[model samples]
Target: MKSITFLTAMTVAIAATGAEAKTRLLVNCFWPSSHFACSTVLPNWVEEVERVTEGRVTGIIPPKSVAPPPEQLAAIERGIADVAVMFNGFFGDAAVGPKVAMQPFVGSHDAEAMSKALWATNREYFADEIEQVHLLSQFVISPAELYSQTDTPINSLDDLAGRKMWVLPGPLAEITKKLGTGVVSGPAVQSNEIISRGVVDGHLGLDPQAVQAFQLMPYTKSTTKFSGAIYSTSFSVFANKDKWAEISPEDQEAIMSVSGEVLGAAFGRAWNEAAAMAEAAYADAGIEVVDVDPAFETALQEASAFVTEGWLKAAEAAGIDGQGALDFYKSQIGEMTN
Candidate 1:
């Protein structure tokens, strides 16, 4: 009886220590818990990390984000959060490489292809540009399209220019201003405030999924379709460097097996499916889809030239062959679609 009691106590102590030894990563989500990224993508990623690491490594989303969207990268670097995702545009001049995926009309509507191409391109030309955190995956969202809340159809540049519009930050906002459009610009999360208060007559930079997620359906009266992505947002998933280093190298390899291109493709597929569902919902909401007028398309494309030029210049400043990288990314997309 004494021997059996000692053995049971030893077994229980060992199990408790094992549980305490497991590493739990804190994954932050800036979007609401119900948002697809939080409800689907991030949770799926955490599950994969646990599975691949054979339960040695695990992750959890805190009840709230450790920081706001713009400050996510810095927060992760400071070890306030172990893992997070950030928008490339929010990084601005500090990280120019990811913007290769953001240039207007360069990407297709297919999010998976663009996401994979971005991962490949970054590996080839821009890997060194990232610092402080360990990059896990890079992905791009579906393109933003023109949507009007007012009676205007946005059939011409004149129609677009005449209305006050909410544009996504970065290139789209710059492009809209150059075209003489009255632009109210901020992060996508803040879009509801401006649009709901009757601040803008139209919105120029939301994908179908975003339109659904941001609850902009009632305000959206019509959508203007472009031949390709009018513009796309780029995203990066990363982990705190010190926290990453704490994991065993073998476990790191296991975790990475499910990250990089694999994770990017997965995120893209989710966005694609969600975007499709949202578009289907548009008809039910009485939102009209307007075909782009050829002249308007041509003129908007022409006016947006400076935005791309500025990015290319910034890329060169970062010591990359901007045009070459762009061409490679575009060619990769073409190959995938073909």
Candidate 2:
């Protein structure tokens, strides 16, 4: 009887210790819960974490974002959330490494390729810039195109400048303002407010999926596509440093087995599928898809030179070989495309 009682006590104690050792992570989503990144990407990663850790590590996302879009990284840094996604633009001049992915006419429309390349480049050159939080993965959406609600298609800079345009903040806004366009800049989620009220003549920084997701197709009469992406936004997924440290080293390696380039490619594939759906929706919505004129494309590329030059200089200041990274990124995209 004494032996049986001792064994039972040991069993109970071991079970309690196992429970105590399990880690539950709080993941926050800045976009609406229904947004693919929220509904799909983060949740998928959480599942992978649980699977790889054998249920020792798990995660849950709050119904809504813990903070505003621009504040996501700060929230993670402050430990308000264990993990979150952040736009590179929110980093401003503090980190120029991401700008290599944002340069005009340099990125591919393939989200997966660009995302993998971004991760590769980050690991090789920009790893030091991610000091505030534990970097997990990087991703970019499909390239953005200029869309017009007005009768006139935005085939030339004059047409764009003639109308007040709603553009995504960061490089696109700066480029438009430099080219003399009347610009209103904000997060993509807030685009509907101004657009639905006729506050702007057109929008300058949404891809097909974003247009469909934001319900902008009804107001869009035409969209102009460039030979190369006009611009693409970069995002970083990261965890709170303290929270990351709490995980066992074994579990950390297991979690990362599904992160980095693997996670990036997963995000890219999702975007590619979504954009394809949005393209079909564009046809059904009767949104005219206009090819950019070669001469105007050249002129616009020339005008956007300052954005890239500024990025190169800023990257150099950060001790990264900006040109080499940019060239490598482009080459990676090309190799993947071919």
Candidate 3:
């Protein structure tokens, strides 16, 4: 009986040691628990990591954000968080490499394509700009769809004239201004008050899936589906350099197999699927979705030139062929669609 007990104790000890050998990474999900990043993307990515590593390495998202969105990258860089996701625009110029993803008229409404294109382009050209953290996946918000409080038809370019509209900072703001519309600029969170208080006649930066998260469907009565070049926000999921270094080379290869562009493409596909749901929600909410004519599309395309030109110039200053990157991204997207 003593020898049998000794053998069982040794078996348990070996199992405990093997379990301790697994590397568990803490994934910092600053988005709300219900937010897609917390509820879906991170969770799904974590599963992939565990599966690919065969329990060699895994990750966990804390109950609350370790830091605010803008600070997520810095937090990871400082080692406060092992992994994090950041909105590239919030840090402005720091994530200049992926800014190509934000240039209007360059991509289709296909989120998966855009996400994959950005990752491919980054690997090809802008990896230097992303030196601090290990870029896991880079992506963009689906193009913005204009939502208004009334079923006012925005059929012609002239219809938007003088209307107070909420625009996110950057080229979209320029496009809104060029349309002869008044711009009310603020973050997405401010849309609720801005619309309720009549500060802006409508918000121009949210699509249907986004509206569901913001609870804007109840207040919105109309939506305008712009052409491929509308607008979008860029973001990236990354890991701390040191934390990444701590991961064994074999595990690193395993982790990245499911990360980077693969993970980015997954995020885009998920969001695009959610976009379909948002469209249904729009119908249920009685929101009118206006499809403007070809003329309006031409005008939109024309206005977007300024934004694209400026991005190109900025890209050139950053020391690479900006036009080359843009062209590559578009070509990559085309390939993905095919």
Candidate 4:
């Protein structure tokens, strides 16, 4: 009888231990599985998470698996995904702190500097908005450049007037429209289709790697350097608030230690590498790359004022202090770049 009781107690304890040990986290990436962010950065992040957690946490990334880039945040909020990489521009209707980062002329062309600035901005002013979800990391992509099929170069601001251009909807689209270009809203992944079909005369947001990743270089006849980083997208790795709450405090600290500034720098380095690869690919493809004339760069800078004004108006409508946030973000970017 004593032996039987001891055996039963051991069995119950083993079952309880097994239950407690089981942990699964779902990580969603909007980019296709082949993209560097999904293929390289995510895997490295997963390894780091598991290593720090010591087998208490495990993550699974489904192939080509993601919600619409804009919907990633809602998916997490609804518990469809425990964690996801979200783009701030997608939250057009909300008070996302990073909107200031997307305003024209606010960020430098350097992804590393932009990423650091974004992280610092979050720490100083946007913490509450992001705290709703457990932010794992923050990063920014390189600025989008102009790619065109026309042999005539974009040497001046007037060159863009009345031209049909494929532009992603949101802040970037707003900037394109302000430039007097006919804007077509479409996913970045479909840029090849748009260019191949001649639905667009050119595209305004082709990052070097993105152009190469989607094979847009073949269709691209010319590339124009923008005055400054025309615009950049902000990305954040976040988990559901409840799910993050379940993590042990020690585990949370471990994760946070690896996130923010450190993770931002890692992503920036990856983007820099991707940019190098893209430049080589474009050269090999015989595509013409031109630096915008100084006069044109100045025109672009002047045009940027309209974009900034529009952002301020939009932010006011959303009940956020647009000017204050913009000022803070600018100061942070200056510090990081300097």
Stretch of 10 with least lDDT, candidate 4: 89-98
Q: How high is the CA lDDT of each candidate model?
A: 0.90, 0.89, 0.81, 0.79
Task: List where candidate 4 sits over 4 angstroms from the true fold.
Answer: 1-22, 313-321
- Alpha-carbon RMSD, each predicted model: 2.4, 1.4, 2.8, 2.7
Top model by TM-score, which number? 2
lDDT of 4 by residue, 109-133 (tens): 7787788777887777666665567
lDDT of 3 by residue, 1-338 (tens): 99999999999999998887788888998778887878898899999999998988888899899998779988998888888888887656666678888887777788888899988998898877877888788886677876777667565667766587877767777788887889988777667667767677777777668788778788788877766747767788888888888778988998999998889888888888888888887778888888768887787778678888887887888786888898898899899888
Give the worst 10-residue stretch by lDDT in candidate 1: 88-97
Angstrom error at residue 152, model 3: 1.8
Off by over 4 Å in 3: 1-21
Q: Rank the candidates by lDDT, best first.
A: 1, 2, 3, 4
Error of 1 at 204 (Å): 0.4
What are the per-residue Cα lDDT tens digits for candidate 2 across 175-209?
Answer: 89988999999878889998988999899888889
Candidate 3: Cα lDDT at 6: 100
What is the Cα-based TM-score of model 4? 0.89
Candidate 1 residue lDDT tens string, 117-189: 9999999999878887899999998889899898667978889888899998888998888889999998888
lDDT agreement of model 1 with the native: 0.90
| Candidate 1 Cα deviation (angstroms), residue 73 | 1.3
